[model samples]
Target: MFLEVKNIVKSFHNEAVVRDLNFSLDAHKTLSILGKSGCGKTTMLKIVAGLENADAGTISLGGKNIDNVKPGKRNVVYLYQEDLLFPHLNIFENIAFGLRIKKFPEKEIVEKVNAMVESLELNGQETKMPHQLSGGQRQRVSFGRAIITSPSLLLLDEPFGSLDAGTRQRMQEFFKSLTAKYQITSLFVTHDLKEAILMGDEIAFMQSGRLKVYKDKTDFINDPVTGVQNEIGFWENLIPGKVERETLRK
Candidate 1:
């Protein structure tokens, strides 16, 4: 296991938000966690990123216990739905921010930032500011910025929630390719069931502060609590026999 979270618990105003959470993720794989609003998804990611304190539990990353590590020192990056790029910086500078913070040599920073910009498909737009880019493009820059530093873990909280349907789908595909290219180990939190299924190498569902990690996609789809069946039923009802026909064709 590259990242291990054990017996994690959290509360606010004496109301438990996360209960005895336990999970392990392998390096270079993405685990997509599906949960509705206020299901402790963001809280869990914050805890793992060291942004929030866990009342009890242990977090280990890359074989080292990080329970007491500071957010900056944890070598973990937390990305939110908003592409929180620096408005003052151009695309190139935004992606280069992390490297600059670490004070990498000037030549290396240029090489790395340029390469990242190219990978993000923003080569000629390096001088453009965040406001000048489309939603998907800005999000790509955001991803490039975070990934350039090569963090040990990346926590994504509904990263495409703000995009339009078309842009969101494009971003999903882009994210898959980006993560693979970087060999990123990420915990992707989303309420969107289809997105969850498409993004994860392994899948888990969170509800009422507890989590259930499925053994595989088949198990996840079969679990009634996850609402996959309900979704299937809705479509089946909408166009009678459509699902069965598609399944049979396959």
Candidate 2:
């Protein structure tokens, strides 16, 4: 296991938000967590990233216990729903910020940043500010920035939730391609079941701070409580045709 979260527990006030959460993720794989709002999904991610303290349990990454590691030194990155690009920096500079902070040699930073921009298809827009790009484009920039650091783990919290349907779909496809290209180990939390299926190698449901990880896609799709099958059924009934059914399957 590349990342092991063992018996993690966190509470707010007097109520437990995450209860003995235990999960392991291999390197270069993705795990998607599905849950409704206030299910503590974000809190779990925050704890894993070392942003929030866990009252109990441990976080191990790369076989070492990182429970006491500082957030910056933990080799983890957290990205939120909004693309938090620096408004003052252009696309190139925004992506290069991490490397600059690390004081990488000038030539190396340029090479790496340019390669990442090219991979993300942002070559011609390197000089644009965050406000100049569309929502999807801004998010691509965000993804590039986080991935350029080559962190040990990436925590994404509903990163595509704010986009329109068409843009959201495109971002989902883009994320798939980026993950394939980078082979990043990511823990993604989203309420959208379709996005969960699209983004994760394995799906897990989070409710009331408890996590139930499905063994595979079949288990996820077949589970009644996940409501994935119900959502699919809704689409199937709404559009009655073999083509529509096949489209839904895809």
Candidate 3:
């Protein structure tokens, strides 16, 4: 296994957020954490990313206990719903920030940044500032910055949630291709179940700080008590063939 989150419990002001959770992931596999608003999904991701610690639990990456580790050395990169790129830095500089911080050679940093730009289709946008780019472009930069670090794991918190339907679908395809190409292990958090099915290899459903997994898409759709299936099924079931090609396009 590449990551293990064991019996995690987090609370604030005596209000439980993440209730006793246990899950693990394999190397190079993508996992999505799905739930409604304020289900402690984001908190769980933060715990694994080392940005927040669990009140009672353990997070191990590559067999190392990282509960007390600092966020920078945790070998995980996080991309938030909004573009969290450095506002003052240009695209090239923002993506190269990690390499520069690690003191990589100038030539290597250039090469790495260029490769990432090409991969992310940010070729000519390298010199643009954060305010100059569109929402989609800025999100791309956020993803590029995280990937450039070569982190052992990546966490995306509703990365495409801010984009419109069309742009969001486009990014979904691009991100899916990128992750599959790099074989990156990630724990993605989102409220969109359709996004989870299309972007993640597997998904864990969370309800009020609790997490559960289904055997497959079919099982997920048929869950009686929770109705935890992907939104596509829910939509299709409600309106047969109403799901047109355009509705699900990238």
Candidate 4:
């Protein structure tokens, strides 16, 4: 396991938010967690990123215990629902921010940022400010900024939740390719069922501060609690004979 979270618990004002969470993720793989709001998904990610302290349990990254490590030293990047780019910075500078924070050599920062911008398909838009870019473009810059530093783990909390349907779909595909290109290990938390299914190499469902990681996609799909069947049923009900057509095709 590249990232191990064991018996993790967190609470606020004596109310438990994450209950005995235990999960492990392999290197260079994405684990998409499907959960609704207030389900402790964001809390779990924050705990893993060391942004919030866990009340109990341990977190290990790359075989080293990081339970006590500071958020900046954890080598984990937590991305929010918003792009959170620096409004004052251009696309290139936004992506270069992390490298600059680490005080990398000027030449190296330029090389790395250039490469990341190309990977993000921003090309000539590097000089443009965040406000000048489309929602998807700004989100791409946000991803590039985080990924440029080569973090050990990336935590994304409903990253595309703000986008329109078309842009969200495009961003999903773009993110998939970006992850593969960077060999990113990420925990993607999304409320969108289809997005969760499409993004994960492994899948899990979170409810009431507890999480259930499925052994495989098939298992996740078959589990009624995940709501995959419900989604299928809804579509089938909307279109008359859709289920019959699927059955006949099979």
* Candidate achieving the largest TM-score: 1
Cα-based lDDT for every prediction: 0.94, 0.92, 0.85, 0.93
* Model 4, runs deviating above 4 Å: 240-250
lDDT of 1 by residue, 66-174 (tens): 9999999999999999999999999989999999999999999999999998899887999998999999999999999999999999999999999999999999999
For residues 1-250, what per-residue lDDT tens digits would candidate 3 score against the true structure? 7888899999999999999999989898888877888999888888888888788989899998988899988989888898888998999999999999999999999999999999999889999899999888888888888888888999999999999999999999888888887788998888886787677787778899999976665555556534533445567788877753334342
Off by over 4 Å in 1: 244-250
Q: Is candidate 2 or candidate 3 better by TM-score?
A: 2
Clashes of 4: 0
lDDT of 4 at 151: 97
Better candidate by TM-score, 1 or 3:
1
Residue 128 error for model 2, in Å? 1.6
In model 3, the runs with Cα more than 4 Å from the true position are 225-250
For model 4, what is the alpha-carbon lDDT of residue 100? 96
Candidates by TM-score, descending order: 1, 4, 2, 3
- Residue 190 Cα positional deviation in candidate 2, in Å, after optimal superposition: 0.5
Query: Can you give the lDDT of residue 215 in candidate 2?
Result: 95
lDDT of 2 at 103: 94
